[model samples]
Target: MPTIVRASVALLALGLVVAPDALALSKRDQAAVEALNQQMQAAEARYRDAMVKIANADPAGNADVDGALEDMEDVMAACAKQKGCSPTTMLTAYKRLLKQNADAAAGEETPDDGADDGASLAADVPEAARAAALLSADGQRFVKMVQYNPAVQAGIRRWLTDMRGPLIDTYENYQYMRQLMWPQFERAGLPEALLFGVMAKESNGKVHATSRAGAAGPLQFMYATGRRFGIGPDATGFDTRYDPRSSAQAAAEYFNERLGQLNQSIELSLAAYNGGEGRAQRVYNSTGGRNFWDESVYNQFPAETRDYVPMVIAAAWLFLHPKEYGLTFPKVDAKPALLRLSRPSSIYELTICMGNGGTRDGYMRALRNLNPRYQAESWLPAGTTLSATTRMVGLYNRWCLQGQRAELASTLVRSNASSAIVRTGPVTPLPAEDAEIEGGGVGAAGAVTTSPSVSKAKSKPAKPTSYTVQRGETLTAIARKFQCDTGDLAKANKLKAPRFAIRPGQKLKLTGCEG
Candidate 1:
């Protein structure tokens, strides 16, 4: 069921509605009240059937759902005016629907990482006019914000099917950063769901995620665009675009600006966000403020944007109504806290010292996202403070402060690969094996030929231009292994100092290094 029906049904079932004095009313009014209650029940039945069909992707379901809701509202309105109607009597019927929602939610399979899965739709009104106002003013306004077209339906289908993992990850990551990000949108009078949609589509809530086109951060603001919104690089050369609070604030301002210019069209504003404001504004002006869905407007934006707008809307729709689709979002214990280093430590060390604590990945990503300025391998000095969740801080105290695991983590992070290899005096070689062997030949006696080249031809092994970092490796270690200056390696990799932080699997240029 849609949000309206579910919330209304829940509030009604929870006994928010009050009963009228039946004995004081005439017998005719009693009969009218009873009839209205029966109508409400029938409408509710139809609403349930329509919800099922809607869940199954039936086109007729939307109309039927709306019709049933209207019918129920009409009955409730009439009963509010009727002398002896008891709103409590509607509870028994709706309680079943409420239980169904709970059961459905419980039945859905949660992913191993975590697939996890709010507002009263209606108010109990003793007065008829108040009841009508409550229904019109409060419960339905949220539902009216966006259009759920076929494009949105397709987007929803994709999210529920192939894109489900991304949706879950976005939800999980957003929860960790919600305190930092959501307040910006909330203060701007924007919907929380819209914020989720944009972040979900843009970066799946990865704080340091950068697009190939040069957009950076959780909200994916380009360098120039971010500067306009007070989210450019700081004096220290750290881009605030990667900061959740800064980026979300910029995003809120951006959407408000676009919405104002685009006649309050969310699709248009979203188009501007993805396709560039210049194109979106130009299309808006040329179309004479036509709806974004109009062919003249829709066709003007690039295909990426055309897909983006709908996907964003669909995500927002699901955000508001997850139970309706049987989708669950995992719960995160993300209570924010500050962690002052008890000793100098890197995030890699901290991650190793602090166990997973039931999370699939350790707290590494969360630490990186929350404390973007520091690289995962960058050593944070004693007394340096970092943003963290309460759970993480607790874990740090329990497992990372001064234990054997903590020492092991520190030792691991400090390890150097170059120290492990030793050089010995050159020795006699054996006969070479088959010449057809790849990567040079081995000897038949298992001792390889020591010649630099075949037939006295002097040649050198080509140096590699790039290298992929391996796990538990560092920039200094890599530089040592390749017999290159650490400073030169960092410069080639464009790594920032003093952190010069690098993650495993990140590619680096091997300029000035022997490979």
Candidate 2:
């Protein structure tokens, strides 16, 4: 009622345009607009219910109720006038009202009605103390919204396409690893679903994934955390986190420890994983030791952690019901099988070894897609046998028959010759062990012993440079500055704009520009 009319008028002005020159909308467009308007009406009804609840609960806050109602009217007016505003916009407005009401209620002191103390926080509490009281309720609601949000579901669909077979293969690998680690999860009484969520978030199911944070494997367990759970680097230079089976076990154990300390709440355990256990513990203690969704808990952590629980729940929901959510998961021609290579090889080397048969290019793409943690483009390194489907194995066998391993090894030697020579220097010849490990045991055709010094002398390379674009600078201007065409610049940087309207701090590639 308060300022609702003024807000509605303003929104209508911004959203609707009735002009003589305006083109008539098609029947389909009109129908779509009507649908959006109906969604707005539904959203408004829900918002009004929330406002009524707020007014009834807080006797002294007619002002908050008035503001909420006004905002709702404005949002509805905007939707009606535009006829193109999505359900997302309407829903967002409703949620904003609910959040504001919740925040206000959390800040005041009110008598409890013998409801679960974990359901909400006491009013009149300080900002820091309020999060613990409200986090549980907020967390539950957040998870629900994420599970149902159509836009979020659409995003997951896009991600599935980009990830395709590699993610599926990795998920299958996770099942195998989970089997070996189930005992640990069972012993800890931790939810099995938590592992899947963690794996998806950390590495998109890639067993060999590593993070910049030094968290390794599917769970992204750091060295300290891994050590705490009895998983770490071994004598063979294998970090247990890189091994699917070992990492799964360690993740289960670590999660159990957090759950034990945090009242068996998965939300709190997750917060500890993203932020830190000590911070979570401090927050829990500050919020009267309630569950993670207590309003008091939200007030304690950073914004990233506030959103993390919802994201995790969203991912879990998608994984459980990909088809229901309209996600087109990749179809596998056949179930993937793990192959143990007798010799160590890099992913690059393995690609060459698996040569041009039965979709070898597809196999390499899948390997890169699955193992994003591998920074190097090629070579899986020696002693590391990779898991791939039958198709990949057939390709690898074909490449082996062609006798191209030596050729590939020669290319690698030539490529890395400069770095190898520079690092080893003249007096200290390349170590035999290092050579064998890096060279992947060069073939009998002088592949292994190709002189690094000789190769370095023959290869010629150019240096890289940077370029800056000024105000009103076109792609043509920037390209000309670097002595290259506009098309080359666009291609190199993947610019989609017809003409470059470069903004400050926008980097343009000039590394390969010709004079």
Candidate 3:
């Protein structure tokens, strides 16, 4: 009875669309409105059941979602034309359904067993910040609508061909951090494949990858943007943008908001992700929300974004159907485990002691990725716990807990290059070519003598006029290393203020730096 009363009120409120006298339905029209409402209710129930199946990864879920959504849409359209039915009432019911789904999804996001504390990142995520089920009607529609044009096909080609190695690497890396990262997206009802696609394209799954524009983390959130989404520097001076879990959560929140604005268009939302949201919104508005693939809409975006949307889609598609393209992603044993350090050790030291354990490279990358707060070289105290895999924990116990290999690893890491070289007498110059030879013998004084350039001129080697940026190096770090004024160094390289953004291997003028 309350539902009927609400429908009557909606019809009365929507009188602007019809004559006020026509607000009251005749007996036959009343029957039609009630029938439409029943159809909508049945569709909503089916959608809820399908969402549960989807969360559990059931194949039948997709078909159920499609059918339910079609039913709802059909009812809504019929309601719009029905004399006594109100489209506004139908729209309100649809919104209520989405809100219910969102709330349910958010409630189901309990902390994983491996979480360090009860107040885990998943637990901390606000309900409103999470999205409705990706397998729900709207999300399924977006998935069904994604186009595989030539641009996307080209992206697939690149991923399967030249970028194949990177794609494989991304999958491997994502596996190790999947527990920490994927849950964030999952809780938001985002597709896991989309997360991988973005991570693959953005950073090759490198957690600390920072772009020239100062975007950081696996999701590559720019600093300002990261701040808006509750991801910034913590009190410990660690930027959460470099954190896989937090960054993934922030990225999900970003896409959730963008998709809401872009009428659930994945291409447009992705374009917003890469290009500025303001630019994406303007284009959407000017085109009256046309399809993103439309020439008029597609051409308006920058070259980078135009490439980015399809590439992401292609990567996601490959993620969904890797075997279809004859690509087999390596299987990884990613069961979460914790490693409590038996003694103080660096990640580099752990890597040496951990050995290959059947992996091509050791656990160095995994260690860095899982425990992003600490650098590879930064020593952790004894009993310090680290997020690790079962395999890594097993390796640590076998090889790293105060055994011969553990001692050897510790010695190797502690052995300094400077300490290895001993000077006992005045340096004697040698031929440049000879100086470059490896393993030159110690001098008569039982110390290694300088092989090159005891340059008698001693005019201080000419200050380098230019420098190539190195990985993980920031402008401030470079300034400190080169003893240059930060402002002057930025100006010399024409870098912008605040961010002083620079990418690895970017060339910069060393004009303001000293020898």
Give the lowest summed-lDDT range of ten residues in model 2. 128-137
Model 1 residue 314 distance off true place after TM-score fit, in angstroms: 1.4
Query: Between prediction 2 and prediction 3, which has the larger lDDT?
Result: 3
Compared with the true structure, all predictions reach lDDT values of 0.75, 0.53, 0.75
Ranking by TM-score: 1, 3, 2
Measured against the true structure, the TM-scores of the candidates, in listed sequence, are 0.61, 0.43, 0.61
Instruction: In angstroms, give how far residue 91 of model 2 lies from its true place.
Output: 46
Q: What stretches of model 1 exceed 4 Å from their correct place? A: 1-143, 431-515
Residues 1-515, model 3: lDDT tens digits: 12212222222223213221257678998898889889988988887787566666666765776677667767765765788786556656556654565465467664344322212222322321222323232233234647878989999999999999999999999999999987777555467878988999999998989999999999999999999999999976689999999999999889878876776678999999999999999999999999899999999999999999999998888988888999999888889999998777778889999999998777888899998887776646667889999999999989998789999997776554443443443576554554544554554224435644543345445777878899998766676556566557777788853346789999988776763
lDDT of 1 by residue, 1-515 (tens): 23454334324422333455557777788788778877988988997897576556566776776677667656655665677777556555565655555555456543343212101111221121222222221323334656778999999999999999999888888888999988777555466788899988999989989989999999999999999999988988789999999999999889867765665577888999999999999998898988889999999988899999999988888888899999988878899999998887778889999989778667888898999988876656678899999999999999898879988987787666775775343444544444244554455335455544434544556888888999988787787677666667887788866668789899999999876
What lDDT tens digits, residue by residue, belong to model 2 across residues 258-314?
Answer: 755665466787889888889999998788777666677866889878666655655
What C-alpha lDDT, on a 0 to 100 scale, does residue 387 get in candidate 2?
58
User: Which one is best on TM-score?
Assistant: 1
9 in model 2: Cα distance from truth in Å?
Answer: 59
Off by over 4 Å in 2: 1-192, 207-209, 333-345, 353-361, 364-391, 403-515
